[model samples]
Target: GGSPALGTRLKYQRARWERKRSRTAKELLETEYKYLEQLDLVLTYFVTILKAKGTLKPAVLETIFGPLESLYSASHVLSLHLEKGNLGAGLENFCQSLDLYGHYAENLEHFFCSLKGISLFCCTQEQVRKNKSFRRFKKLQETRPQFQGRVLEDLLCLPLQRLHQENSLQLLRVQKLLKGQKTQVLTPGRWYIREGWLLVVPSKGEELKRRMFFLFSDILIAAKPCHPLHPLNSNKLSCQAVYPLQQCSVDKVFGHTWSQGGLLSVSLPTLMQVLFLSWHGVSCTHWSYRLLVTSLSSGKEAPLGL
Candidate 1:
């Protein structure tokens, strides 16, 4: 296409101009350092005004400028290495500089979400391209033809990947937290409750109904059985109990039952010993059930209560 041909011609012209501007990498690096000094003067002027007006809090100012200091230091070191013809050291410093920028990008997004973030964003968008530090980096890279294609592109874009990976890890932690906050172990069972017969029948009526209980890391929940008996039928399970385990201490747990009630009882540790039902006719034995609780609660470690 004509556009591709035009782009190639423009690129060649840009390369020629760049070569005329700086004969070698050292020259380019030196030029960048000089430009940075000019930038520092301008930045210092603005910072002084901001400080005089009391617009910049000490902590906020540190947060904003700490990364910039590191970035500048890295660039200066890289330039020194370049001047000394230390390519190895210069490349090492270059990668470190990129990593520092990645760290800065990660923090910058967080900063932008803060109180004065929007104004900063607008100011930077308006003035950042004109920034000497930015132009310096662009010029240095432009002069180096070896730093073309995927090699340089990926190195420059390392910050975006770092941001994405950090965000993904945060999201993963949130999901794990949400999952841990809820009940994990659920068992479908039955509970026998005595029911009195009608007065006309004149007989004691006893019935057993399907009951289910869920054991969470923090609380225990009693629920009614499902109609269709689907394992994942959440809608069918009606809430019957919600006992917070933190307040209650395990008192007695009975595994064997002789046609009579032999369920686990928990005594709430308070001014008065409040008794709460723990389990009756669970599928697992008392010790096995306790192990399950330990595994779920990670050895009685209470949930964060968040």
Candidate 2:
């Protein structure tokens, strides 16, 4: 609703500002040179502060997939809608309206601030990873609780690195993936070849299920002995096979196997994997997943129905 009005005013003001700035003095070469020097310094300072502005940092969003990125990249209006409103086709419509609103609406400074806090929120998650230091800081027991925002955010991410040394898992690659993403760019299909881990990226067309399907398929194809999602034993109902989930087998129908000229079938193994992963704390969000993936002992199921 706001894009058109904002667009025209922004365009006109920007053009006016540029024109005023570009007008040069015919007689004052020395003053013009100093003006250019000051302009450059001011521009540099703006860049530096914005870089530290939180949401713009790539390290803040590694596990959120590009969904967070896409949300931040939309017209500030649309991103706000996505975060606050329901998830569905309506948000997509707002994102698509970029053609009419122009980039100004999408690139508002408030949009950037929101992303950083969200990024801080994503990277500093305490539940899934459960690092001792992070847990200590997050709790009211010891560390000062008043500090929030990026200060606490980075403090939280500091412990994820320690997971590599303790767990014998290569978490450095994950850190690199988080760090390599540039300002305002959210890469959904980020896969680290060293880790052999492919994050399931969500697209505008696909919701949670499609991304999960791709992640499930990718994990199934890249199995090792006694791994969490190897799909070790399969029973076929039709064209599809049932891979009984390790836990939560009775909790929910994980996946259904399809048949030819017949009825539908379901697999329990996939459900177990999903349930097992969920129980261990892996999630679609960065903060939650970071906690889960960093400290997990691997292949151990949480006490579910037991």
TM-score of every prediction relative to native: 0.28, 0.15
For each candidate, what is the lDDT?
A: 0.41, 0.27
Local lDDT at 252 for model 1: 38
lDDT of 1 by residue, 101-220 (tens): 656665566445443324343324434444555435434544554433322223323334432432243233222222233433321221111111011111244343334443444554
lDDT, candidate 1, equals: 0.41
- Clashes within 3 Å, all models in order: 0, 13
**Model 2 Cα RMSD, 1 decimal:** 24.5
Model 2 stretches astray by more than 4 angstroms = 1-75, 79-89, 93-306
**lDDT by residue for model 2 (1-306), tens:** 347766565455445423432231111223323333333332233223334543333432333222322322333343333343322222334424323222222222213335345633333444324444433433432233333222433323222222122112112212222212231112232211111222321335443221111111011112211111224311100111112222212222235221211111222343422321221112222212222332231232211101
Q: After superposition, how far is residue 85 of candidate 2 from its true place, in Å?
A: 6.4
